[model samples]
Target: MQAEIGLIGLGTMGSNLALNIAEKGHDIAVFNRTTAKTGAFFEAAGALRSKIIPCTTLEEFVGAIRPPRPIILMINAGEPVDDQIEALKPLLSHDDILIDGGNANFHDTIRRNLLLDGTGLNFIGMGVSGGEVGARHGPSIMVGGAQASYKRVEQVLLDISAKYEGQACCAWLGENGAGHFVKTIHNGIEYADMQMIAEIYGIMRDGLGMQAKEMAPVFAGWNEGRLNSYLIEITAAVLDTEDAETGKPIVDIILDRAGQKGTGRWSAIEAQQLGIPATGIEAAVAARSLSARKDEREAAEKAYGALGETLKRDAGPLEDLELALLAGKIAAYAQGFAVMSGASGDYKWDLPLPEIARIWRAGCIIRSQFLSTIAEAFEGAEKESNLLLVPAFVEMMSEAQAGLRRVVARAATAGLPVPALSSALSYFDMYRQGRGTANLIQGQRDYFGAHSFERIDRPGAFHGPWAMNAG
Candidate 1:
């Protein structure tokens, strides 16, 4: 019997995804550049091995799948992916679909889509989230390509995707690069969400004089409330763990610095290009960059004397911390969705905002009960309206903003760094202001360069009289 689908790159993600497809009753042919790994994977498959056709060569892998094939490339995102696509072009026949399943730069995805145009081979830039565990079981799949091409593989994708209340967390997002773009923004929100949580952790540790064991229950308790999510649940679990060798908290034994791939940075860049204020994501990216300069930070801390240690004080009630986190999260998600909205307009993709939120309600790292609220907000929202402006969110922000303000004020006084949270608060403040201070900036620009400014009283652009006095 012929295999239903073929997959390349039997790395961690690829191997797990292949198993998931097979477990869901689809025969999958899999290949790796190192032929030994393919055999090793098949050997490890055990009961599911019967459904896997291990292929030693690209030709064999392509041939194993039936005609008008659907092949998923789970390779690295850059040149390696391009190389694989080029190698497969000759081996693949007309109507064979190629799916790029990686954390790709959407721009690159668009280029590859255009490159494969009229080749009779369909190209899909698919975004797969939920890491190793999600791949082995189910993942949230974001597919982008021709509608017909997506329909060909839709059932298989649905079968392998996570279910939220029995509905699959997968959808054909748009054409060309939309899936990757949304995934990039997802990572951005993840960074912001994590950074805010870390800021709260910093407050608990430095200001409240709390240890990991003491903080564990706090986060665990928050998980049962509005902040209930996978990240919170795991945060509680991680804090409770101890290092076996040293008997110290496992988190204390771990390195302070964090590592990042390019997705968070990409999200910031794309937001700036589209003129959207994704300050929460930007602050998180900047914070990560600062964290990476560990040597410089250590030297500076020694020179200036450590402030985090000296600023120990009361951090207010735990309820305030929880509310602050929720508010910051709302701002971060709002900015992420705003960036997506801007990109949709720029690309003419006509992305379904509500559907995007609905699909993200499970499987992804940032999946949470909060997303259901976002989905509901988008359902009744005007096309160009911001999430902050949505009535439900306005009511939420009204109730929650006070807690955020108090948290920021306390963190500021205690000299604790709360970049993402503070940035979110600032974005919220600026966005809601009917008249901002930017008119002075416009006046400065006009005075120096004769650049025009628009009067609020009138529609057309006008120059400031300061240009007349410039020599």
Candidate 2:
């Protein structure tokens, strides 16, 4: 009963996280359904094994932790989480805290919290980002629960989180579902980011007639500037790597189809339901769906005739592609944050936008130099203003949007697919406009459905009596 924290599930993430905690000098109790896993972990733990108490059974695991315990669940999401909660609750006392560190749907977090209302068990829905290696080292941690409940394990979380400029990339974002909601939206932005990069790569491949080796240097160069990020760094490595057996770029050997595990789609669906226009994410998800329909694409290619090996190479003035990528990134972040802002207000979360930006500065898939700029913008702006309206970002958009316009136009004429970039450009354009063409939509709805439209000269809704006299 000397362990400070107890963890269940011995999956890759769970095992690595348990090792991290133990190496951090915290006495932790670990349990897996299979006893052999627990045995193997201790054998591999080396010097850190002394701090880890491996229990063969759940009951033994529960008894190993001290009072006012914090039990973390790093299992699969969906029904597994719900089922595990029911199984573990009987073993936990009223003062215990259960933390879900998996990528969960926020609504499910809210529902679970609601279900455990008076049970006296504290539920913390935490979003742990960065992949397997990050879990073993330090990942950005987003916590959503009561302040008191967060306080109980704050030090441990901070200690295990990645640091950016001497600050921990971890914080309590809000209460119930807020953390997972932020993570879902983060994945949404990640989708847009990856897709935009892939679209740019498509241009380099088809339009420029450049190989992966040629493009690797380009991505590497971008990493030295404002676009420097984990994704960019990794993209360079991935593209530059050659398949040893085939003697070709590894990327060329890989399948064109992209795989997704729901978070990106969920974010897009959530944004649509919330009536927040996250078009970049939406376009990215759609692009993935298009990629997945391989047979249909093959049939279409056969019917339409494939566009030969080399494009005419006339997508000129492409020196500003970096600027275009930057602009698209800004648009994606702007849309994502807007969705977050809407959710914050709708759910009364009062999420710390600046803090969110700060935490995202490191240890996350989207970590970048641009995040510091975002943090500064949020720190200086009125809470009601969008990122595009921030002074510095306004200047960025003013300078960069012209380049974005040029790139999108060139890609379009070159017959290159740039859906994410094109959609991002459109979103930015729509956001800054005072008047839009939706007035025609209003008129059409009124004419057909008698929905009525508001008049600029008058206060009330009005309908045209265009055919009354003739009828």
- The best candidate by TM-score is 1
TM-score of 1: 0.98
Per-candidate TM-score against the hidden true structure: 0.98, 0.96
Candidate 2's residue-wise lDDT over 1-471, tens digit each?
389998888899999889888878899999888899889988999999889999998888889999898998998999999998898889989879999999899999999889888999989999998888778888999999888999999988998888998999999999999999999999999999999999888978887788999889989998998789999899999999999999999999999999998899999999998899999999999999999999999999899887654444543444577889889999999999999988899999998888999999888999988788888887773643678888778888888898889878878877788999999899998888899889888887777777889887779988877525323
Measured on C-alpha atoms, candidate 1 has an lDDT of 0.91
User: How close to the true structure is residue 166 of candidate 1, measured as C-alpha lDDT?
Assistant: 97
* Residue clash pairs of candidate 1: none
Best by lDDT: 1
The TM-score of predicted model 2 comes to 0.96
The clash numbers for all candidates, in the given order, read 0, 0
